[model samples]
Target: MSTRLIIMRHANSRPESDTGLDHDRPLNEQGLAEASQMSQALIDRDWMPDTALISSSKRTQETFALMMDVPCEIRPEIYLAGLDTLLPIATGIEEGKTTLMLGHNPGCEMLIATLCGTYHPISTATCALFTKDGPHWVLESVLRPEALDRFKRVPYEVE
Candidate 1:
């Protein structure tokens, strides 16, 4: 069995005006719903992670909390980290384990490109699933909140 990696960007956060610090910004209401939707999608796809590496930022932490219940390590250095900071972590995952990395872009975006040779935008609440293929990583799927049916809004009728 090959190792699998799920790279995800934290859900949308409240503006810095509300938190006074970028690191302290919390998820907005829409972000909460997006997190919940993505959580179910992961479970349904049987992509539940065995372990997770999460950024220490409040938004990333909250995003992980709403999405998963698994062993996780919060790394302060992951906040707004780039490929130089994240690639080593990805390369070090034990073989055959599924690990999730919840962080920000363009680090998340950079990781996907470095591993898979393709770059997909890592938007709020977006997940890029990658599986190992021989000596390289293969991009499996990219899950976005906007593309999930559960997140679609039903038109309201005026009574």
Candidate 2:
């Protein structure tokens, strides 16, 4: 079995002025809804992770809380972490175990590019799912809040 990696960027957060510190900014109302929707999307796809590596920032914490009820590690080092810092953590996951890493971007975006050799924008509340393929990682799916409604089947309207 291959290992699955879910790289997610934290949901939309309040401005730094509101919290007086970037680390303390919490998710806004829209973020709450986005997080909830994404949570259901993950459950519907049966992609609930076994373990979650989350950033210690308030927004990231709130995002995860609204998403999954799984084992998690809150890492202070993950705040605004770069690809170099994140790569080792992601690569260290045991084979056959799915792990979710919730952090800020450009680190998340950089990690996805380095692993998949393709760049995919990871906006607020965006999730990039990857699966190990032999010695390499392949991009499996990307879920964004704006595109979630596209999955629904709408009845055709009679002209």
Candidate 3:
């Protein structure tokens, strides 16, 4: 049985405008639009997850809310989690199940590199899909905002 992982960075956050705490910063207009677009793209590909592990930060929550309609575990540790904090989640995945892990950068990027043995840029709203066969993880696809625009099935209009 193979386990699939969808690791992603939260969408664009609002510009610092007195959002005293970094954890409280919400998604901007563009972020909301991009999140909606990305959500539709995943749906079109039938890539919805059975479970989602998401950071407790406001932006991550908002991003998750905009994406797939799935059950998610709010992991406070994922907010600034390093590889150590993330590895356990990936390793603990049950066989033949899919999990979406939404988190912050540097760590998300590092996790992808460590698991797949390659470096890929993890910009905001970037989602990389990986599948584990036996003990080795292989990257399946990467969906960035630009890529979403090109692959989206439905036209998303920013409101």
Task: List ranges where model 1 is wrong by over 4 Å.
Answer: 17-19, 151-159
lDDT of 2 by residue, 1-159 (tens): 579999999999888736498899999988998899888878877789999999999999999999989999999989999988999998988789889999999999999899988788888988888899888988888888877754661221212
Alpha-carbon RMSD, each predicted model: 6.2, 5.1, 5.0
Worst 10 residues of 3 by lDDT: 150-159
| lDDT for each residue of candidate 3 in 1-159, tens digit (9 for 90 to 100) | 468898989999986636688999999998998888888777776778889999999999999998878888999999989999998887787779889999998999999988988888888887888888778988888887875565344422212
TM-score result, candidate 1 = 0.91
lDDT of 2: 0.87
Clashes of 1: 0
Q: What local lDDT score does residue 116 receive in model 3, on the 0 to 100 scale?
A: 81
lDDT of candidate 1 over 1-159, digit per residue (tens): 679999899999888736498899999998999899888888878899999999999999999999888999999989999999999998888889999999998899999889878667778998888899888888888888888876552221112
